[model samples]
Target: MTVGYVMLCHTALDRAAQVARFWAEAGCPVVIHVDARVSDKAFASFGRVLGDLANVSFSRRYRCEWGTWSLVAASLAASEQLIARHPEARHVYLASGSCLPLRPAQDLADYLAKRPDTDFIESVTTEEVGWTMGGLDIERFTLRFPFSWKRQRWIFDRYVDLQRRLKIRRRMPAGLVPHLGSQWWCLSRATLKAILEDPERPAIDRFFRRVWIPDESYFQTLVRQHSRKVESRSLTLFKFDYEGKPHIFYDDHLQLLRRSDCFVARKIWPNAERLYRSFLEPQEGVQIRAEPQPGKIDRLFSKAVERRQRGRPGLYMQSRFPRRDHENGKTSSQYSVFQGFAELFDDFPGWLTRATGVGRVHGHLFAPEGVEFAGGERLANGALTADASLRDYNPQAFLTNLIWNTRGERQCFQFGPRDHQGVDWFMATDPNAQISVISGAWSVPLFRSDLPFATVRAEAARLQRIETRYLEILRSMYVKARVRIWTMSDFIENPMEPLQAIVDEISPRAARRLTEPPQMVDLTGFGRFLQNLRNEGMKPTLMGDFPVNGDPRIAAPRGRRPYLVQ
Candidate 1:
């Protein structure tokens, strides 16, 4: 279930890098394509942050235009580079770097592994007219325009309405049926390879070159026609306002985002750093698979940062006295391991009490009220009291086959996922799933995702024992780990302001049009030229208001360099 990521981003390298790093650290190979419409300073900085990662790569920039062929071209270019770079990656996840993971990596990985043959793509046939904006599927497929529709979209749409009123129907390319859906997807590598290697791709590319919002239709149509195994769903969650653009995630959307049962969520705005960070951190009952590390002592130990952090308003968890006691004295040396365990197995029953023979506070083990097992099946009947004889309290009987893998020690004890109890141990990848996996000082729970609860639980029982043991030891080395959802103290100053203000900040003389609102011309010499070509029975493979060598109209080779962003 190894995966690769292909991110198409046009702005905010800082935000994009965080997402790239998140996926890269999760062991997925990542390929990024920055829209050539972005500023050079932005592209260069984005490269610096992401290029350092061994698993990350970049495609030559493309001046991707919305609602035009360039966007599809960029996606195909990125796919080629991505699949070539990660030949073994079973799935290639297409996303904007602004997208954030809703579940931990392992959860997504496990979900894909369970359905290894299924492709998570949202594709519906051309007959599904409701998907077309205002049911204008024909307008998107039949029209051929030289200018981008996004700019002056009203002009193109007015023409479309005029055509409908006048009963004008243009013929579509000979044998193709248009399909439309969200562009974001987790495509099977075999399917992607088929797309890249398909002999008819050039012909299909030519037909869609002029289609409005080709990004929405190009891959959807081709993959539907070419592949048989599709789930008709995308792994990324998105919410669109009436205008059809993705809404920005904010502080208030946190809980809604958590319970969405999605692996990724998108349309993250730049200033929404706090929201992004929370997704990266383990939420309650969800232990995000660890990021690669031997902690950076300098950052963790910096007194200045610590003081600053303490002054800021943030969520902090104080461990129960038993773990805190273990964290004191010589035991504190394993603080990361202890912290990892605490965050992961926050409420696993009898863990810190007179159970597992770790540290029995009172002769009787006490669990938090409503403790649950791997399948989210609860066992604890009531509150955590000093009373030794709670109605449903049992020491060893609570959980059998408990195991731990300590950081510094190598010895006899061993445990992993294949163990039947794993389903009850690491709560099936639900942020709400109540089980967790604890190895000595470290513990992790199931990451949240879209898999059915039964599947998740059953799958947990089938995971390799080594995967469990390996991850626990791997995640336990980070000291003071816990769930953190940040909020802006110097807050709520228009999120888009920073994006707009970048012009003045980075390079003032850069092209000003890329940032402008979407619009297109009704009459242009280039538009006429494209229409003339179609009238002449010419089927051009690629068409756009993009510079190919010298002139925007001149045809360019498949892998030529981009002119705008540099």
Candidate 2:
């Protein structure tokens, strides 16, 4: 029995892509239904990454107005389509774009296949028990409007406000008590087929047409009523705060995420791209741009700082040579390079020889000052260029050595470029793949403008130029490699002031789609950036460090634990 995951997505293309990518490796065919109200451009952007996959599908754009039947109706329509398209699928797990698999795909599939008789969903009556009003009520579940509420906010705002203030309680008709549970559910084919084919579905649907929030409750009520073996607890994982808002994940939650036994989680912001990359296996075709070119000692050292800081230094470490003599004019030419700096700096010759020339570090040797780099020609502007070079002096090397190895102790490199203009390369075999920039800083400049202007302005412009250059280079690289992410490294560090003009100058040329746009990942605030970005129709990613208060939820406790041998 093959179990598949069906994601009901609405205007969440990037997330859909992420979910699809995660599932692809898990061997599960995915199907997505974008609420019809989503723009064609949004669908196209999602299709660009997911279109090639035979397992994914998009529902015809159907209007899903809030507090309307359209939302529930749309979900039913999409689910039916998925069932028709993939008849062999034994079970259908309905998830939102925000959902992420918590368990390995194999485990979830195995669990589902073993439980063919049971339906995993959350459902319970709230007839006598009062539940939170707005967004998830029975009234809202059955009601469906033609357009999104926000689009008609001007007209709907007064009514919504009035409804909120009135605290009006509508009595449920006889035998139509409200039931509520998790928005996500996984059900067997038999149950889903029965629900879809029910001749009395219209009767139930008609009764809930006046309900407050039907999307969340309608499915739960119907599934519970229909399934013989329904699990009250949702198998998918999510944590909500006391206020009912879903808990947002940050870097601090990494440990918890690793420990989570569920197959997926939800509500991850778009800016969490780095976290996504870290969780996935290293793609055979994906090449990190942070490594130094082989044989280029200067570039190697320059790249070491970024690579080491991130705890993932690359090839450069193999040939690293430390500063043997701090005293002026001490010749290092005879210092054998056979052994790495670990041995050379230890004041001992562990493996030094003259035959292979592998360990010789002769500092006395000097090439002509004007000699150009090897494998590279001079640019039209008369600047020396090289794909590979052995240089004694460079800005990257100088800065890196000063910051990390000034004391001649163990040094590490950063994973990304340390200096602004330190060109990084992404090697892709194709020439026209997609490359996007996914970071923005509208809030920083808007809020911090009152401070000193020149330094802030200069810094913003400098970063923007680097970002622009990165985009340009990425475009070229994508032709060969298919680079899909262009996240802004530092977006929210701007001055508080009017930054409209500055933002306009920094924003990139609009493309056909923004699979990866400039999104602000404000590690400093309670996702203040998310609020602003979403308001502007720009999807932002949440890129904060885990354990904000140094909490170890995302990390291990400092001490060791004893084993239990009962």
Candidate 3:
């Protein structure tokens, strides 16, 4: 016996007619079900196009809505008609209007003839199903969904919530266990007749009328009671994304669909001329009699789902702008943020470039004037301009874009209290940032400036407050960056070790040790600068204890020479 097709059409009646004609010409009886929503003129034209086929017939019209009882009712009516009219048809394949046959119809008939009793339908218990979306699994069976989810979402949600709060649950019809799977299925004639003619069908239908998306579970659950042998898989290749939406096939998916070896695939683009022309036309030569293997393309669909959900790290695009703290990765690659280094050293950027042997070092990128890109270029990588206003508009995007654009190369930039402090918390929370901070180094610039003592003292108080608040953020529990903080007084005592550690972390692959360290600016009168600030009633707390005499580097004279006792 040949296979019979029961197609459910809602839109794109032209394409549906084409597929129906193709199946009817292949000696398979066709039964079509049109949604009542279609215009009368369109329905008449659709019927006229397929009226030449004697085997093709239209079932009773039903107004179908997604996630409601209408779809199940439509399928029931169409399937019953298909079974009665085409009694020679041993198997009934339920497909959608958009489903295109990927293999020859005769090949499918041959495959089914071998396994006459086997019913191909995806059936699994709620506990075993992991692909359910919308937080509804067992609740779908237990809860009552009377309102349309698409049209009356507000009422639907409130009704579901009200039912949940009141703890209302409906009893399932006795002698039947609920099962879930893809709506599409290929059932044997015996099983279809058994499900349609069951004495308790009226009760089962009444119970499932209030169920959510009953079309998926109606046939799937009932088939278990009637079918002697169930394969627990669909002959049709249907795939959904992270969101519960089906993946639509286009012309570009020609090879992808061919590799699946599935008898039919659904949700094809109506305008994909290439896909329709290539798949609808008969495939010649020896046909592969292998079983339908949807798993062959599962990896590609998994990647597509992952890419749609998590997206590429550090990429901020219109399609996917992740919520705060929800990014796959805050930055694309590793980078360095040096605080107080530029203020305490004469030529820190130049020295760092020479030390690393890679000249990817820039001055304060967030300088109030403009972005100080390397070599003072007007535009940086990714066509990022040096406009201060634009950079300040979105400092976080600027930094992320910089790191993303220069992914292969490591980025190094200087930061200080004088520059914009917008990205302080962002850098501290980013795992890719390597921050080296020398506390209270902002006072150095004030000390050497030829300004009045009152002016220096006022500026020192302002900067000291900003730095103190910044240090608190870095020390907080939420910080993810690699942080190394040293008091200015302590860093001056041993600069080589910290420099070596910072350089080593930046370039771990470099086998050589740091032989040439950045030259430190002379701190002859720096100690007096802090003592002077303290004298002005402003406590310089961030900087470690300093000798009030002057420079901490100078050695004190001894009253008598001491001899070592050996």
Candidate 4:
């Protein structure tokens, strides 16, 4: 006993004919159902092309609309014809027009012949099925779906909602529980005949007519009652995406299909000439007779779904720009932001490059004039230009691109109240950011500037206000960055410890004890500067307590002089 194929063809009749001829030439009866939507001229031509094959026949035509009863009717007509016309056929395999045979017809027939009484179909109760889309589970069976979900979505949704609100539910025909699965299945002759010729078939069909996507549920549920043995899986390889849409295989999937070992694979791209040629043409060597294992390639499909949903971290592409706070990672890699470091240290960028053993350090990147790229280049990695107009247009994108482009290298850049503050919150929330802040350090530049006292006072107040607001954001509960804050007075008292900690965090694997420290800009009269600001009616609270004695450094406590050991 051989296997007969019942194909549902809605488009690409030529490809259907090709596959049909392949099966018929292998001694299997083929019954095809073409959708009524096809033009008469096309249907007549399709029929003439296959008219030479006596084993091939066409069933009654039906206008099959997706997610409607017409699809079930078309399948029923085709299945009935396949059973009656081909008495020698032991099993009926359902397939779609786009499906291509991945293995030889004899292999599939031999496989089915081994399990003559076994029906291969995916059958599971609705409660156990987690793959259903559209938020309909058991409700798909209880609620009447008169409107087409695709064509009349508005009415379909409203009708479902109205039924839900009024608590209307339909009763299932006795002895049948709702089951859902893939539409492609292979049923033994006994099960197919029993389901089609059952005495209660009229009642069962009438009830399932209003069930949403009944083609997937009709045979899947009835086979449990009629079949003596069920394999609970399909011989065809069918995969759906996160959105419940089938993944169409193209020419590039040639090797992927061969690895599945499935008898047939569906939803192939119509123009995939390579796939058709490679899969349809029989291989002349010894064929592997292992069972079909679709699970072998499941990892590839899972990764494809993950990449489509949550893209690689910190990548902002035109095709998949994520919403705010919804990114997998705000920035691609870890980087350092030095707030107030440049002002307090002489040649800070150069010193940092040496200390961290990294070469990507730069001056204030968000400076008003232009981006201070490493070595003052006009452009940076990933062709990121130093044009201030473009950088300021989207400061967040500029910074994210910088980190993404310079990945695998630790990037260090200075930031201050003087630079653009647009990216304040972004850096504060990014987990990849390592921010070392010294409050009131912005006043150091003002004091060192040769400007008038009045101008310095006004400028200090503005910078102070910006830094205060920025500090508030850093201290907020939403912050994810690794932060270390020290006031100007506090940092001067003990600076080496904080610097060592920052460097170690940036390059933990290669970090050693700090033997050489960056030279601090002389703060001899810096205390007087703070005292002067306080005396000028502008209180500088962010600087902490400063001694009026003019010296900012506190000498380390010294031990008593050591005497001779004798």
Task: Please name the candidate that would achieve the greatest TM-score relative to the true structure.
Answer: 4
After superposition, candidate 2 runs with Cα above 4 Å error: 127-131, 134-177, 282-566
Ranked by lDDT from best down, the candidates are 4, 3, 1, 2
lDDT of 4 at 174: 98
Off by over 4 Å in 3: 133-135, 139-143, 165-167, 512-515, 545-566
Cα lDDT tens digits, model 4, 487-545, are 98889888998999988887788857788888888877888888888788888988888
lDDT (C-alpha, whole model) for all candidates: 0.54, 0.50, 0.90, 0.91
Clashing pairs in 1: 150-518, 150-519, 151-518, 151-519, 151-520, 152-519, 152-520, 374-424, 404-440, 427-435
For each candidate, give its TM-score against the true structure: 0.49, 0.45, 0.93, 0.95
Candidate 4 structure lDDT: 0.91
Of 3 and 4, the candidate ranking higher by lDDT: 4
Which 10-residue window in model 1 sums to the lowest lDDT? 484-493
Which structure among the candidates has the greatest lDDT?
4
Task: Provide C-alpha RMSD values for all models, in order.
Answer: 38.7, 27.4, 2.7, 2.3
Model 1 C-alpha lDDT versus the unseen true structure: 0.54
- Positional deviation of 412 in candidate 2, in angstroms? 49
